[model samples]
Target: MLAFDISGSMLKIANDFLSTKASCNILLYQGDCTQLFPLRSNSLEGILSISVIQWLSEDSQIESFFKECYRCLQMNSTAVFQFYPNSPEHADQFVTVANTTGFHSYLIMDMPHKTPQ
Candidate 1:
């Protein structure tokens, strides 16, 4: 497994926490999500992002990020991201960009009672 973050300090904290557990298969690295990932094309089975995509403030950056994700993932693979959008429009923008980047995108709301803002 591979994990990356733009913050080295965050990676250090993660590394420290992982060290307390049994042997882990995860490889931690410092990387920017908006830039090219340090991985070969179609090399990854899937990717996961937790509260990360919200940081991409520009459409170009989002497009680049999605493009890289699509390039890295194998055919029929998935990339799941959990993010808090500032508004409904922001969330829609993400899905639109992902779809434009050739991904069959879907938006799932965990809280059905609350409307997405």
Candidate 2:
């Protein structure tokens, strides 16, 4: 598993937790997520990113991140990211990036309401 984070402290915590709790191996990379990863092409089976991609400050970076993810994932693989976009445009940007990078992207929305009889 590859866990990418920008904060060194968070990475340390993740490494510590994985060392003690996880049976499988995990590689931790602390830096900009858009940069080229030190991994081979089509090397990863899946990616799990939580509340990270929204921090990307530019479209180029977002595009680069998606491209890198695409390059690293095997065919028919998946990537799960939890991002809270500031607006519809932000969400659309993510989808555009993913689609341009060859990922079939979909958004799942949760709506909760009390129904009146």
Candidate 3:
């Protein structure tokens, strides 16, 4: 498994946590997600991120990020991104970029506050 984070500290923390539990080899890298990853094409089985995508300050950055995600995945691979959009327009932008980059994307809302107590 491969994990990327902008914060070196977060990557270290996740690596430390995973070391105690996970049996599979996990590679951790700290860098901007918008840039091309060091991995070879069609090498990754999956990509996952939480509260990460929405922070891209520009549309081009988001596009580059999605393009990298698509390029790094093998055929029929999948990625799950969890982000809080600033508005409906922001959400639409994400879907647009994903489509342009060859991903079949969907948004799964997690409304914890709306759940019945």
> What is candidate 3's lDDT per residue for 40-113, written digit by digit as tens?
99998988878899899699999999999899999998899888888878888999999998999887666623
Q: What is the lDDT of residue 104 in candidate 3?
A: 92
lDDT of each: 0.91, 0.86, 0.87
Badly placed stretches (over 4 Å) of model 1 are 112-117
Error of 3 at 110 (Å): 2.9
Best by lDDT: 1
Cα lDDT of model 1 by residue, 1-117, tens digit:
987899999999999999998989899999888999888999999989898889999999999999999999999998998998888889999999999999999999776356678
* lDDT (tens digit, per residue) of candidate 2 on 1-117: 778788999989888788787476777888878899888999999988889888997989998999999999999998997888888788888988889889999987444234788
How well does each candidate superpose onto the true structure, as a TM-score?
0.92, 0.86, 0.86
- TM-score result, candidate 2: 0.86
User: Model 3, which residues run further than 4 Å from truth?
Assistant: 22-24, 112-117
Winning candidate number (TM-score): 1
What candidate 2 gets wrong by more than 4 Å, as runs, is 22-24, 111-117
